[model samples]
Target: MPSPMVSIINVSKRFGALQALDEVSLEIPRGAVQCIIGPSGSGKSTLLRCINQLEPTDSGAIFLEDELLGFERKGDKLLELSEGQIAGQRMKTGTVFQRFNLFQHMTARENIVEGPLRVLNRPRGEVMDEAVALLERVGLADKSGAYPAELSGGQQQRVAIARALAMRPKLLLFDEPTSALDPELVGEVLAVMHDLASTGMTMIVVTHELAFARDAASNVVFMDRGRIVEQGLPTTILTEPTEQRTRDFIGAER
Candidate 1:
C-alpha cells in the first residue's frame, strides 16, 4: 500500500503550563478532504501550525510523504533544521489562516506571484501567468488588480487561497478560515473551498462549519482538551459519533 501523504506520530506540543497537544497521531491520505472540529482553545490551530512547521514541536515527529519534517536524522540523533532549511521544507505545504495576511501595498496578482518569483526564483513572466490562472481558479480573476483593502472579506480570503495555490503545495492547511468573516460572507469563501475539494486537493481544514464538513469532507475528526475524541467518515462521525464527548460537542455545535 502507498504510504499516507501525512503521518503525524505521537505529536505533542506544550505552551508553558498548557498542554497544547497531547500525543496526537493521525494519517492523512492523499486527495482526502479532512475536517477537524473542536471548541475554542482546543488546540486546533496549534495542530495546523505544527503541520506547517510554523511552531516547533515539543515532542514526537511529523512526516510528509515519509520524510521527517523540521528535523533531519544524523546517526541516532534527531537534529532540528535551521531556519533556512525549515523554510524550504515548509514550501511543500500551503497554509491559509483566519486573517487573509496579504500585503496591503501589493495587488492581488502581485501577492499571488511573490512566493514563486522570490523564493522559488521562477521566471517573472511564467509566475505572473500562473498567478492569473490561480486567481481565476479561486473566482477572483477580475479582482487581481485590486488591493486587499479594496476587497470585501470574502474576496480577500479568496485571494488568500489563490496565493497559497500559487506555490503548488502538496498539502493545504486551513485554520478557522471563515471565523473572521461576517456570517453572510462565509458562503462565498466556503464555496471556493468546496470547489477546491472537488478538484482533489489534499486539504486539512480546521473549521466549525459542520454543513461544509458533512457535504465536502471525506473524514471528520473531533478533538477536545488536546486529544482526538474520535475520527471517522463524516456520515458516521458527524451523525452518529461513538464517544460521549463527541456527542456532547456535536450537540453544542448544532
Candidate 2:
C-alpha cells in the first residue's frame, strides 16, 4: 500500500498544567476526508494545529508524504528544523480557521493572490490568473473586487477557502468551517466544501456538523478530554458507536 498522506505518531502536547493532546496517533490516507467531532476543548483544533506545526508537539512526530515535518530524524533523535525550514514544511498543509482571517484592507482577489506571490514567489500574472480562477470556483467571481467589509460572513469564509486553495496544499485542515456563520449562511459555505470534497482533496475537518460528517466524511473520529474515544467509518461511528462517551456525546448533540 502507498504511504498515508499524513502520519501522526504518539503525539502529545501540553500547555503548562493542562495537557491538550494525549498520545494521539492517526493516519490519513491520500484523498480522504476525516472529520473530528467532540465538545469544546476536546483538543480537536489543537490536533489540526499540530499537523502544520502551528503548535509544536511536545513529544512524538508528524509527517507529510513520508517527510518528517518541522524536524529532522537522525537515527532515533529528532532535531527541530530552523524556522525557515519549518515554514517550508508548513506550506504543504493549508488551514482554514473558525474565523475568516482575511486582511481587511485587501480585496478578495488580492487576498487570494497574496500568498502565491509573496510566499511561493510565483509570477504576478500567473498568480493573478489562478486567483481569479479560484474566486470563480468558490462562486465569488463577482466579489473578487469587493473588500471584506462588503461581504457576508459566508462569502468571506468562501474567499478564505479560495485563498487557502491557491496554495495547492497537499493536505487541508479546517477547524469548524461553519461554526461562525449564521444558520442561513452556513449552507453556502458547506456547499463549497462539499464540492471540494467530491473532487478528492485530502482534508481533515474539525466540526460539529453531524449531517456533513455523515454525508461527506470517509471516516469520523469522536474525541473527548483530549483523547480519541472512538473512530471508524462514518456510518459505523455515527450510527453504532460502541463507546459510552461517543454515544452520549452524539445523543446530547441530537
Candidate 3:
C-alpha cells in the first residue's frame, strides 16, 4: 500500500510503575477500518490516546504524514513540534467516544457546528449546512433541534458522530463508541458505522463489539498486556485466530 497515513515505531508508555505500552509498532494504511480488541487495561485506550497526542508516550515515535506526533528520542534529529503545531495536525482527524460529550446548553445542530465555527472559523451558513448534512448522514436530521437531554443514549452518540463528521476530517477514531449504549440501541450505532466502513473512510477503532469488528473491519489487531498479540485480515483472525491467546480471549468473551 501507499505510505501509511499513520505510523508508530517502537512506541512505549509508562505510568508510574506500570508499562501501558511496550515497543508497539504498526502502520495503518489509508482508507481502511482497523479495530483493536483485548481485555480492559490492555493498553488499548492508551494506544489510541497516544496516536492523537492526547497522551505523551515515555518512548518511541509516531508519524502522521511527515510530522512527528509526539515522543522525542534522544539524538534523533529532534523535529519536535509545539502544542499548536500538533493541534493543527490533529484537526485533520476526528474522534467519537463512548460518552456522547454533547453540549447540554446547545441544540444538536449547534453542538455539531460549534467546533467548526470556533476552531476552523468557518462561515455560519457553511457550518450550519455541514452540520445538517452530517446529522442526516448519522440518521439524526430530526434530532438536530433537540438537546442531549431530549435524546436517547443512541441518539446522542449518533449526534456525536455527526459532530465529528462536521470537521470533514481525513480520518476517524472510535474509542469503544457503542460500549455505553443499550443492547437495543447498539445495533443502530453499529449500522451507522457499517455504512461508514462501506464508504472506505480510514478508521481506527478500539471496540468490544467482536461481530462488528469482524464484519466491518478490513484488519483486526489483538492487543494484550501492552503488546500486539496478533494482526491480520479480519476473516482469519475472527474465524481462525492463530494465537492461543486469541482463541482463549475470544472464548472467555463468549
Give the clashing pairs for model 2: none
Worst 10 residues of 3 by lDDT: 70-79
lDDT, candidate 3, 111-139, per-residue tens: 89988999899999988888888999999
Report the lDDT tens digits of candidate 2 across residue range 1-254. Answer: 99999998999999988888999999999999999999999999999989988998999888898898888988989888999999998888888989989889999999999889999999999999998899999999899999999999999999999999999998999999999999999999999999999999999999989999999999999998789889999999998999998998999988
> Where is the poorest 10-residue window by lDDT in model 2?
88-97
Against the reference, the lDDT scores of all candidates come to 0.93, 0.93, 0.87
The runs of at least 3 residues in candidate 3 whose Cα sits more than 4 Å from the true structure, single-residue gaps closed, are: 71-80
The segments of candidate 1 whose C-alpha lies over 4 angstroms from its true place after superposition are: none
| Candidate 3 local Cα displacement, residue 136, angstroms | 0.7
TM per candidate comes to 0.98, 0.98, 0.95
Model 2 ranges with Cα > 4 A deviation: none
lDDT of 1 by residue, 54-107 (tens): 899988889999889999999988899999999998989999989989889999
